[model samples]
Target: MPKMKTKSGAKKRFKVTASGKIKSGQAGKRHGMIKRSNKFLRNARGTTVLSAADATIVKKYMPYAR
Candidate 1:
């Protein structure tokens, strides 16, 4: 059988953690920073774990990650 292909977009955006959780960058930082507060920008600086429901879908796209 042929190998299953991973979703390219998901592979770029999501990462599988050591404990099997999915990590991704927080949203709303891409544009309009002038209107956004400094605290909001500061808080969104790092990656965050995906919620269980969302992680399930992301896992489907990255079958080999787990």
Candidate 2:
């Protein structure tokens, strides 16, 4: 049998926490920030846990992360 390769993109984007939660950055901060409010930008400035359904898909890409 052969070992599976981790998804490079996923590895860079997602993080598996010690408690097994998948954390990812919030979207919408890439551009057009001038139109956005400071509160929105402040709220988006950190990682958030992925939902159960999304975590399942991410886990597939990062088999060793578990």
Models 1 onward score TM values of 0.93, 0.90
Q: Model 2: per-residue lDDT, tens digit, 1-66?
A: 998899999999999999999999998999999999999999999888999999999999999989
- Report backbone clashes per prediction: 0, 0
Highest TM-score: which candidate?
1
Error of 2 at 18 (Å): 0.9
lDDT values for all models = 0.96, 0.95
lDDT of 2: 0.95
Model 1 scores worst on lDDT over the 10 consecutive residues at 57-66
How accurate locally is residue 24 in candidate 2, as Cα lDDT from 0 to 100?
A: 99
Quality of model 1 by C-alpha lDDT = 0.96
